[model samples]
Each structure stands twice: as C-alpha cells, then as structure tokens.
Target chain A: MSIFLSILALVIILISAGLLFFLALPPKRRSRWGLRPIPAFSELVRVLGLSVEEGTRLHLTLGHAGITQPTSASALVGLQALERITAISSVSDRPPLATSGEGSLTLLSQSTLRAVYRLNNALDLYDPQRGRLTGVTPLSYAAGMLPIAYDENVSAHLIVGHYGLEIGLLCEAAVRNNAFTLAASDSLSAQAVLFATTKQPLIGEELFAIPAYLQTSPAHVASLRVQDLLRWGTVIALVLSAVLGVFGWL
Target chain B: MVMRSPVATAIAIGVGLIVLLGYLLPLPVLDPIRRLFLDWSIILAAVAGLVAILNLFKAHWRKISSSRERDYYSLFFILGFILTAALGLLFGPTDERVRPLIMSIQLPVEASLVGLLTITFVVSAVRLFALRRSWMSGIFLASTIVFLLAGSGVFLTSGTSQVIKEVLAALNILPAAGARGILLGIALGSVLTGLRVLLGMDRPYSE
Candidate 1:
C-alpha cells in the first residue's frame, strides 16, 4: 500500500511537471490562464505604488518557519511576493522592512533584497539591516514585531508565511497602528486571526498564487493551472471512490 | 534580463532528484547514499542556524549602540539572550535549573498567547458575520454555536439532548472530511513546488 501510494504521488507530480514545462516552453503562444482576482494581491501592488509615491515604508514579515522545514513552501511564496514588491518599490526613500522569526528566513530575505537591488542596479541602496531576525520562538517573534507594526512611517504591512495563533498579536498591533494590513498564512489558526484582523486576507492556496498574479511568468501560470487541474481531478477521484464504496466494488 | 546560473540550476536539479528518488526507492546501494545526503543536509541546517544566531546578536548590538528610540529594548534583548545562553550552556540543557527556567518563562508565555486565542476567535467570528453575510459565514456561525452547545453539557438530561448528541456526532465527520481535503491539497502543492525547484523553473536557492 505504501509503495502504491508513493508511485501514485510520483506519477501525479511527473504529469504536473511535464504539463507545466510544456506550457512554459511555448514562448510566443503561451496559454492565457486566468485566476480569480485576489483583492489582497491587487491591494498590495497598489500600496507599494502609493509607498513609492508617498515615500512611506512598507513592512513585510516572513513567519518563523525555517527554510528547511515543510512550511518553507509558504516562505518561498512569500519571498516571491517580496521580490515583486522590492522591484516596484526600489525608488522609495526607505526600502521595505522585512522581518522573519527564524534565522534562515532572515538570511533568505536579505538575499532576496540583494537580488532585487542587483536586478534594479540599485545595489548601493541595499541595506542588510532591512531584513532582520526578530525572534526564534513564535511568541517572541510576535512580541518583537509589535514595534515594527506600530512604527509611524510604516504605511502598510504585508505578512505571508507560516504562522500560528501568536499571529493575532501582530495583526492586532497592525490594526491599532492604522496600517493597511494584508496577511496570508498556511496555518489554519493564523488564518482565523487574519480573517478577523486584516482588511485583506489570502486564504489557502490563494497565498501560493501571488507570483502568478503579479508576474506573467509562464512557469508560475502553468503551475497554477496544473494545481487547479489536480484539485478538480482529486474531487472527481473522491466522488468515484465514494460511488465504488457504496456499491461494494472495491 | 537576469542571467541564469547553470551551475546552481544543475546542483538544485541533481540534489532534488536524488532526495526524491531516495525516499521512494528501497534499493540497498541507494540507501546509504540517501542517508549520507540527509545527514549532510542536517549538518548544513545546523550551521545555518548558528549563523542566524550570530546575525541576531549583531542586529541587536547595532540597535543597542544606535541612537534609535528602541535602543533600550535592544539592550534588554541582548542581555536576556546572553544570560539565557550562558545558563543553558553552563548547566546542561536537561539540568533541573534549565528545565524550570523554560517551564516558568517560555511555556506560560506561549500558553497565555494560546489562551488569548479564544478572544481572537470570537472577534474573528463576529467579523466574519459582519464582513460577509454569505452562506459560508452562516454555516460557520451555526457550526460554532452547535459545537459549543453540544460540548457544554448543559442539557444532558433532556430527550432533545440525545438528539443533539447524535447530530454532534454526525457533524464531527464533516471536519474530518474537510481536513482530509486540505491535507491532500497541501501535499499536492508541496510536491509540485518541489518539482518546480528540481526542474529549475523556480530558482529560490539560486536567488
């Protein structure tokens, strides 16, 4: 049974990867994939634009999940979003402040900032201190972020990563400071807090679609399409299995 | 256009394939290699964690020396970190003194944060109703009320209570089904994300 499941997963992954690769390869005639408009992402782009115009700084938090952990997938998505934001907001007086709960995430965030700066040929303005490690533990991380959220110069806060219940404190702080807060998390408990506190919240796989929506990266679009296809396939498989089980055909 | 690093891409693809194949295959020759790769990864992560700690100290130190308004808090943070590390290292990690320190300081703080979640949950539930007056919100509100009443044990003696208990038992299956679906989706996402890294479609490591 274990072997069967492994093989099944492998086959599905291979198929998805193949489809994505094929879709990504056609340079001139790329498939036009449409995703439901995520207001939070759109708002984020707008906020970054406003920040550039107003000279206000934006704050982004990558939750405490280390890059080595399974939750790092969300962190990767958050980095992608950070890259896009940094690219757009490079002209601002102060670059966006990015914080992380874990050490590796801080390093990755700094690397991301450097990469963005290098891409824009503004490496001279890149400040390593902009990407900071706040805390190692969840509560400490949340507590440490309060000041950042409360800063007067911070006009917006975008948090996307793996967070738990402790995220409530940070969200509340952001709310109290009147910062335009957009949050997304893979953790259900954090999602609950975000639903209450944030004006814009990205739920479930919507968090993963930020890069696809922001950039017309063929690979990202193809991945999004494949993910949707796989979801529908899973639903169909579940229905078929239920029908089979009812008839005792298994 | 940004130039792609072929070496980085090759390394990512090669390492990703070996790790994936290692987990799925049980061949005797590949097992040791897989174990070696896993060990190396663990070692690298540990080193990275140490570097992170050093960076943390440097960040706080700079803050302490700077004229920022929050420099005092940075001072406290640095002091606390150094003191804690000293105590933990001087006394073994499993020593009685160290255990109590963690239990007293960290555990209660974390528990209080969790306890605070109940208030947050109520706030979120109310906000959900106010922000979105849709069927999904209605269903969520109804479910929360039902579960709360069922678990309260306030009407256990009544005949209606038995019916309520039965309904509650049936409703329990709904979350389990939902959880399964969520897990399946997350699993698929993780796999695809991994495949993307291996295929060099997303070069996070390179970045």
Candidate 2:
C-alpha cells in the first residue's frame, strides 16, 4: 500500500514538472493566435457582474496547493482566473488582496500580480505585504484569511486552484459577509462544496479553460487542446481496464 | 567581472539526480541522504511555522491593543496557540496529565469550530439557490442538496432506501471523470516540472 501511494505521488510530481517546462518555454510567435474562442463579452459581463458597486476590496486565494500542485489542471485554471482578476482589478483600481498556502505559489502569484500592476501603471499602489505567505495548513490558511475577510470589508471573493473540504469554511465565512463569491478547483471534493455553496462553481475543466476563455492566450488554448486529448485518452484506458478486469484478464 | 552562470545548472542536475535516485534505489547511503533531506525539510518547515506564529502575534497584538472589533477572538487565538505549544514543549509530549488536558481543550473547541463552519457552509448553499436561479447554479444547488440529504442518512431504514442509495451513487458519476482526468494531468505536470527544475530549465530557486 505504501509503495502504491509513493508511486502515485511520483507520477504526479513528474507530470507537474512537464507542464511547468511547457509554461516556462517561450511560445512560437506565429502559432495561430485564435484557436480557442474566448468566452463571449456579454457572458463575461453577466458572469462577472460589475465589480462590487461600492469598489470594495476583492479577496483572492491561490488555494493550499501551489504552482507545482499535483493536480496541474486545476492550478492552470487558477492561474487563468488570477490573471483575469488581476487584469480587472488593474482597470478598475480595485486591487485584489491575495493569500496563498505554499511558498512557491506565493512567489508565482507575486509575479502574476506584479505583471498586472506594471501593465496598468499601478506599480506604486502595489503593497507586497498584502500578498502574504500564510502557513501551509488548510485550517491555518482559513484562520489567517478570516481576519482579512472581516477587516478589509471585501465586496467580492475569488478562490481558485486545488482545494479540499476546508474550502467550505472559507466560503461560509465569505458568504456570511454577503460578498459575491466565485470558487473553482480541480479536486472533486472541493468542487463539490464550491458547487454547493457559491454563486458560481467553476468545476474541473472549466477552471483549466479560464485562460483561453478570459485572456485568449494562444499558449493556454493549445495547452487546453492537449489537455482534452489527454483526458479522452485516459477515458479510453479506464474503459479498457474495466473490461479487462471483468473478463478475468487480471 | 563576476563568473558566468553555472550554479543554476549545477544545482538543477545535482538535485534532480539525488531525487530520482532517491526514488529508484533504497541503498544504505541513499537512505541516510533521504533522511538528511527530510530533516532539512522539517527544519525549514519549523522556521516557516515560527514566522507565521510571530506574524499572527504581531497582527493580533495590534488588534487587542487598539481595542479593535473582535479583539476577544485575537485573545483566544493567541492563548490557544501559546497554551498548545507551551504544554507540549515544556513537559514532554508523552506526559500523562498533559495528554488529557490537550485533548479536552482540543476536542471540544475543534468540534465546535468544525460544527460552526459546517453550519455556515449549509447556509451558503441555501443562499446559492436563492441568489442565482440559473441553470448551472440550479444544477449545483440540486447536487448539494442531494449530497447533504444522502450524507445525513435520513432516507435509510425502509424498502425505498435502496432507491435513495442508487440516486446518490448516480449523482457522483460526472465527478469521477473530472477527478480522474485532473489527477492524471496533475501527476504528469508534476513530473515534468520537477524534471525542469532538475535539468536547470527553470531557475526561480537560484540565489
């Protein structure tokens, strides 16, 4: 059982490493720019709504899992969601207060937000202290975020990436404040709660497709296409495995 | 002039081989090396954890000192952390009297917190249905209600119980696909990222 668990962990580690390489590598300049269609402009308006009419603080979490999360699909989706939130925050002058679990994600999220602030000339407005590197404990992260949610008078909350049941606590706290919430995750358990509790729950692949849907980034679109192919391949393999098992081939 | 970049590349290859070999082989030398790495990780975690405690103390101390809203909560937070750490460290963790004291405080407080959190979750779920009645939200809301109903085991103990179980089982089908595919993708991504770090393609860790 221990060996099986170890092997499973190793496989995830390897896969995450592969995707990081693709992200790190420079994209081909001429790669057809519009392969994946962006989500409709009207849909974006409807889905996102106006950024909290009062210009209140926005709350964003990168989830407990970091950039090197074992579940890359969710993290990829989370990165896209972060990009969208930061982009909008820049345009509206409503800086999003970000929190994170892991050290690596703290660094990546800082880069993502810094890029957004630089693009918008809001570099001077940026405060490094807000992007806190909270402890990795799920409940601890929740405990840290609770005070922020209360004190900041947050109007909207957007949480993305890989999560677990503890998300229930976070969402509950956010909702109690009557804040608009958008939650997403690759983990079924987390998604289950988000789906139950939030106004919108971006489940599974929806989280992965955020970049293409929101940013229209060609590399992200291509990555989503590859992801679809891989997903179908997995489905085929599962069917084959089940069939083999039933026929006593095992 | 300063030397050209080589440390990044060297560190990458060195760490990669060590990690890879650590997984592949279980030799005596490798065991000690793995133990050392693990110890280092623990040390790092301890240092990080201490920083978190300090930050929490500073933040909450201000809240209490300034008579801010929910200053009482900060008092509880500080006292809880301090007592928990103090009790465990001062007397060895295995002390008989300490065990019951820790468990007594932890069990009731943690239980109440968990229950409070769960109730908040249900309220949020209820609010989802009220706020957004769209098809997607409706589906999510429905799934949530079904899951909660099933979890409570309210439908058991009658001839119709089998039907209830089947319905609960059916709702879970889509999530299975979502979970499996995502996990496989994550696994593949992790390996590649680790490899890149090992091979010197990504240099965020460089000092």
Candidate 3:
C-alpha cells in the first residue's frame, strides 16, 4: 500500500509539472482560459477601485503565519493580491496599509509594497510604516487589528492567510465599521467564522485562485487548471476506493 | 533593476527537495539533513519573532511620541511589554509568579474574546440569511438552530434526549466530511504553491 501510494504521488506530481511546463511555453493559440468568477474577489476589485477613487486606504492583513512557515502559502497569495492591487492604486496618496502578525511577514509586506512602488515608478512614495507588525500572537494580532478596522480612513479590509477563531473579532470589527470586508483562511475554524462574519468569504481552494482570477497570469491560471484536474482525480479515486471496499476487492 | 538571485532559487529548491525526499523516502542519509533544516527553521523563526517584538515596541514608541489619538493605549502597551519582559527576565519564564502573572493577563481577555465569538457567530449566521437567501443559507441556519438546541440540552425527557443525541451524532458527520474535504484541498494547494516556489515560478522570498 505504501509503495502504491508513493508511486501515485510521484505520478500526480509528474503530471502536474509536465502540464505546468507545457502551459509556461509560448502558446500558438491565443485562447483564454475560463474560470468561474468569484464574487468575493470581484467585490474586492470593486472596493479597491472605490478606495483608490475616494483616496481612502485599503487594509490587507497577513494572519499569524510568518513567511518561512509551512502554512505561509496563503501569505504568498496575499502578497500576489497585494502586488496587483497596489499596482492599480499606486497613484493614491494613501497607499494601502498591510498588517501582519509576524515580523517576517511584516518585512515581506514591506518588500511587496516596495516592489509595487518600483514596478509603478512610485518608489519615492514608499513608506516602511505602511507594512506593520501588529502583534506576534493570534489573539493579540486580532486585538491590534480592531483599531485599524475601526479607523475611519480605511475603506476596505482584505484579510487572507492562516487564521483561527480570532478572525471573528477582526471581521466583526470591520463589519461594524461598515468597511468592505473580504476574508479567507486556510484554517477550517477560521473559515467557519469568516462564513458567518465576512461580507465576502473565499472557501477552501478558492483562496488559492485569487491571483489567477484577478491577474490571469499564465502560470497562476495553469496552476489553477492543474489543481482542478487533481481534485477531479481525487474524487474519482475516492469513488473507486469506496466501490472496491464494498465489493471486497481490496 | 530588481535583483533576482538565481542562488536564492537554487537554495530554496535544494532545501525543498531535501525535505520532500526526507518525508517520502525512508532513507537514513536524508534524516540528519532534514533534522538540521528543521532546527535551522526553528532558530530562524525565533529570531524573526524577536525582531517582531522589537518592531512592535518601536511602532508603539513612535505612536506615543507623535501624540496620536490612541497614544495612551500605546503607552499602556509599552509599559505592559516592559513590565512583562522585566518580570520574565528577573524571575525566569517558568517561575510560578510569572505563570500567574501571564495567566491573569491572558485568561480573562482570551475568555472574553471567546465569549464574544459566540455572539458574533450567531449574528453572522443570521446575517448570512439576510445577505444571501439561498438553499445553502437555509440549510446552514437550520443546522445551526438544531445544533444549538442539542448543545443547550433543551430536550430533557429520556426518550427525546436519546433521540436528540442520536441526531446530533448523525449531524457530526456533515462537518467532519466538510472539514476533511477542506483539509484535502488545503494540502493540495500547499503542495502546488510549494512547487511554484521551488520551480522559481513564484519568488516570494525575493523583492
């Protein structure tokens, strides 16, 4: 069983890598891949535009996961979203504020901010203080964010990372302040809270598709396609396993 | 021009493959290397955490000095941090006094937050119905109501209580399945994201 599972894992990885490589190559056809629109993401784009137009700062938070942690994939995705949003709103005097629970994440957020500024040729406007380390712990981080949520200058809140129950406080604070809230987390418990409190919540793998959906980067889009293919493959495997179990074929 | 380091990518890929191979293969040679990497990660995380603490102090100090609207809160934070650190340094972290001091500050605040979470949960549940009236919303509301009733132990009679217990037991399967599915998706997503990082398709560590 172990050997079979290892082989299966290798096969899946090889298939995904091959597909990604193929997609990365220059294409002969100019066809666009179709993805179902995520309402929360669309809402995020709209709110971001409104914030830019109104000159109100948007806030994005990276939850308690530090940049080096295994769970920091969501933080990476958050940075991707940040890069996209900041590129659009680079002209605004009040560039978006990014808060993180970890010092490393704060540094990464600063780097992301600087990258955006450089990309947009607004490097002179970059401020390190915009990317803040609010708190080190989850609840402390949430507590620290309450003030930011309540701050009248912040028009929209986008939180995407690994989080737990403390997300409720942050989301509720935003909701009370009437800020546009779009929250997602890889944590199941946090997702439960987000479903209840956030105006728009990204569920499960939808969080991973944010950059692909927003920017339509070929790599991101291709990765999304590979993920879906793997998911379908997983479902089929599950069904087959169940059938085999019932028939005493195992 | 942005400085893109091929060395960084190479190191990342090397370390990532080492860790991945360590997990998948039962090779003895990779074990020590994996352990070394793990130890390095812990040390790095600790240093990063310390830097974050110092940054927090600097931020609060700036707020206090600037006479911001909530500067008093920053002052309180600074004092609290200083006092706690002083206590921990003087008395040691595992001291009984330190434990109680930490708990006194942490317990009530966390407990209150948890208590607040219940209210937030109900409000959000109701808000879901208001925001999007759909079959999923209806089901969520129904399930929440049923679970809340079961949790409250409102059914006191022996027969009805047993029936309620059975129903609750059955309902547990739904969330368990959903949680498993979410976990699976997260695992896969993490793998893909990690692959992206390893392959240099995503350079999150770079500016």
> lDDT winner among the candidates?
3
The alpha-carbon deviation from the true structure for residue A179 of candidate 2, after best TM-score superposition, in angstroms, is 3.1
True contacts kept of 1: 0.40
Worst 10-residue lDDT window for candidate 3 chain A reads A24-33
Model 3: colliding residue pairs:
none
- The iRMS of model 1 comes to 2.6
Q: In terms of TM-score, how similar is model 3 to the real structure?
A: 0.92
Tens digits of per-residue lDDT, candidate 3, A1-250, equal 3867767776777788887767656556545568886777788888888898899988988888976677999988887777777777878867888889987788778887887787777789998788888877788898898877776488888888999998898888887888888888899888878877777888898889987877736788878877888888889989999999999997
Q: What global local distance difference test value does model 1 have?
A: 0.78
lDDT of each: 0.78, 0.62, 0.81
Candidate 1 residue-wise lDDT, B1-207, digit = tens:
132678988986887788777778666777787788878877776776677778878878987787755467788778878888888899977899787886797788778877776676667677776554567668767877876776787556556666766777787788767667666776666666666777887776555
Q: What level of docking quality does candidate 1 show?
A: acceptable
Quality of model 2 by C-alpha lDDT: 0.62
Residue-level lDDT for A83 in candidate 3: 72
What would the per-residue lDDT of candidate 2 be over residues B125-194, giving only the tens digit for each residue?
6677675667887776676567667667676657666676787677667657657766676543334334
Compared to the true structure, candidate 2 yields what TM-score? 0.69
Off by over 4 Å in 2: A1-55, A65-95, A101-128, A133-137, A176-178, A208-225, A240-250, B1-17, B24-39, B62-75, B79-88, B139-207
The number of the candidate with the highest DockQ is: 3
Using DockQ as the yardstick, the better of models 2 and 3 is 3
Model 3, residue B86: displacement in angstroms? 1.9
Model 3: per-residue Cα lDDT over B1-207, one tens digit each: 132668877897889788777766677899899989978977887787787778779878888888446466788899989988999999998999898989898889888888888898778876887666668678767877876776676764666756766777787688789889998898778778777776778776666
Q: TM-scores for chain B, in order? A: 0.84, 0.66, 0.86
